[model samples]
Target chain A: MAKGFVAITAERCKGCGFCVEFCPTRVLALSSAFNSKGYHPPHIVSAEKCSGCDLCGMYCPDFAIFGGRYAR
Target chain B: MNEATLEIPYEIPEGARNPVEPFLRMDRMPHIWCAGCGIGTTVNCFTRALLDSKANLDKVAIVSGIGCTGRVAGYARLDSFHTTHGRAIPFATGLKLANPELQVVVYSGDGDLFAIGGNHFIHAARRNMDLKVICVNNMIYAMTGGQTAPTTPATAITATSPYGVSEPTFNLVALAEAAGASYVARWTTYHVKQLARSMEEVLKKKGFCFIEVISPCPTLYQRRNKMGDGLDAMKDYKAKSKVRNGAPTGECTLSKTGEIVVGKFVDRERPDYLELLKAQMIESLGDRYVEPEEACCSEC
Candidate 1:
């Protein structure tokens, strides 16, 4: 059961830094390690510290992040 | 097969198709751009970047102001805005705020960004808005019949500048970096691959990203300056340009014989403006619709 609807789709993420920049609670962090696309991907740097704020999900240019299925 | 006059037939790989096509309407080949213009190459680089990044097509939005480059937004197969002269930044700003999920990009000529909408450009960078701006610097204003522009080299002949305009040109990359843009880069049309890679980098960057492409305006600037064809302009760029990476930020000056330093000019981290505003909105109105500014005034 996925309690928190907010999650990052690693394959779709392009490491554009939007999530990291827009996260109001500083919940998202871009890993130095590259994904399958040879580019960095965003991660849940402090998931335990997340407030379910959904800022990262809302600001992502790609639909890489989803939150509560109420994405903008 | 005879060694002296053998003709070889080559076929393109079926899987390795040209990505620019389908996205581009080749029937529209030889666009209205003047001979020796770099706009074609610039447009090619952009489309290539889009393909290389593999960004979500439906989630992209291209915005532009009035100029040769401004016409680019209309050609792209994405949600595009053919905005007013020198006002693409504000329009893009609105679009980004309304839906930050869209990849909003502003593609405009130097005059549009540096002269008419200079203030908006500065403030947009200062706010660190989550957007990408690709400004094509062809020195003189080409579309409006070749007039002197902020990027026009001093003493350059133009319809408006008869005895070599006395005014100095603007260093756009430096301006954006100083204004707080999180990502900034400068490249010439000669460096197609480099420009494409830079565009991809900026597309993935978090905050406001600014890229200045030194393109050629052969019909306008070249004819007036006797700079020959667009290829000649590229040759000039290669000869005159001095590649400088991570240069210190300050007032940008162009010396006659020195390098025209171009590279990843700036990359930094900053909180984007829209998210901050969103947080402020949630605190104030509890997710209600905020009234938009009515008039095109300073109050907005």
Candidate 2:
């Protein structure tokens, strides 16, 4: 079973762009689509290939994300 | 005849407590202060004031606006808020009103307080709220690459005032006293003991208290203006400053031809704003505020 990863709270994210630029594995990306507030939303580019590095969570300003193993 | 065995007792200087052991954050240590800058001396005076006041460490909150002096809040060992430029007074006012028991202090630079936040400063003083504000005036805006601040002397060389400041500076003590602050004082870093005493007095004052500490920013202000190094700047402060406790505002101007008056300029007692508000609160609430319940839970 693949190890699960953290979740990011979409609403609280300040859109500082730290997580998208920091993750070494290049798993996160800013989508062209916008959130309710009209800012760019962060999205997982490779959910199935997550390395569980936790870099995104560390760099996030809003404490929006948490990671764990995938659930059934 | 026993000169060889003059057993000396190991001693520390008066008010000396572990110089290397930082009561402020070391990560923020060696702040943007110029080498031997006097702001650090002011920071030391503040820490000493805290120790002298024996104020509840946990109940103390320091708020700072942007500039060189604003960095002090980040380093102090207490609940500190590093807020935006010139907004520390308003932020501290809110904090004091909210918690009444907290020792709220707003430490800011000349530019932050007298320039951008001048209106707030005057209004806060007029309200006479229970808060202490320490405005560190280096006579120039040491941050933002040296500009002519509200406290900058006329004819000072600065990035924005390449020709000369062409503007007279504000006398902060008079400004506070006229605005109705209960306590007002001005002291330079060379007057460390006096500054500490002023801080102590302000800490205990019931209404708004303002202490303007004249500090030296040798790096930006001095280097660009040819004011010499930090030590030289300090020597200048010591030699040029004239001691006058209650000198009129006109005599304290920071000019080559004017006397640099330094001392406690004003002190008075008045009904504090928070106390008045609390009295009004109790009168209106009529025991609702006093409603006591143990192990309380609320269902939202």
Candidate 3:
């Protein structure tokens, strides 16, 4: 199966968790690290499990995250 | 070279850009909307629509009135205006009339568009002005402490309606149709794909187009009314929304507990304001009237 990955621009994330909450594969989690704005951004937890569905990007209002597919 | 050493390094491309980045003003990071606020979702769909419609970004303009949704104009990277409360429609009208080539979009909240700006809304629709109006109906005045709004559902608890709202709410879809709008649709944040498609259609359309986005205000409206958070509201929408394309506008009213009728309620053709004006001038003046070299030439 092809694996998908997501890249999150930390600085733009407002720690809304919409991306994490809406991720069907539950591969995202809010990170302890904070950006300059002091907001927690989403990070990949189970990289291998990502489906690259891009639901996180669709539901995200911040435009801080995006997803794509890759062959393992 | 050894097989291990000959392997190409697998690396994600550098400078990868988010697909929606070009449509947004990245400098305005960390937008003011609360967590789970549906306004951003609407923005996402809208930006996607802009991309899908192949609209000329330089010639597109976004106008917004004062409200939470009004902030859309500021976030959009295209030509945008943050107008006064309830005045976004009129402002957009002027922009469209002055520059017929430009695609004018009015993004605003229900309170600002329907309450304080109700008169402008009716008139704009009646004239069938060439404008795309996206009204985010969060059911309450989110920025103003969850006050009851014209789009608020009857008997819904709000900041100003502690005892539950008693006034009848405005059926926006019906109102738009009655006022002679050429295109009308309604969708929720949960329906992202559909919403984006609808926005694309609106952009391609010529006459007055209105899309009501039923979103959740988690911070104010939901919390005050015990409607749970944004996700919960979205879940309810998923369960309760009914899609009836081309349904009668009069049957599209949103009830407190009834199923939400969501779909393309109206789609038709009509001569827009500028088209009518040009025809009238040609008929009245015959060969004497001279057409302007350009619709709104800045040099002229």
Interface RMSD of 3: 8.8
Per-prediction DockQ comes to: 0.01, 0.01, 0.36
lDDT of 1 by residue, A1-72 (tens): 212334555555555564565555675667766656554666665554555544454344333454442222
Interface RMSD of 2: 27.0
Considering only N, C-alpha and C atoms within 3 Å, which residue pairs clash in candidate 1?
Answer: A16-B204, B155-B164, B242-B260
Worst 10 residues of 2 chain A by lDDT: A58-67
Off by over 4 Å in 2: A1-72, B1-22, B279-300
User: Which model is ahead, 1 or 3, in terms of TM-score?
Assistant: 3
Q: Any idea what lDDT model 3 has?
A: 0.87
Worst 10 residues of 1 chain B by lDDT: B1-10
On TM-score, the leading prediction is 3
Per-residue lDDT over A1-72 for candidate 2, one digit per residue giving the tens place of the 0 to 100 score: 235454555544444454566555666676555555454546676665565555454334234443444444
TM-score of the A chain in candidate 1: the value is 0.75
For model 3 chain B, give the 10-residue run with minimal summed lDDT.
B1-10
Q: All candidates' TM-scores?
A: 0.72, 0.71, 0.90
Interface RMSD over true interface Cα atoms for each candidate: 19.3, 27.0, 8.8
Give Cα-based local distance difference scores for all models: 0.73, 0.72, 0.87
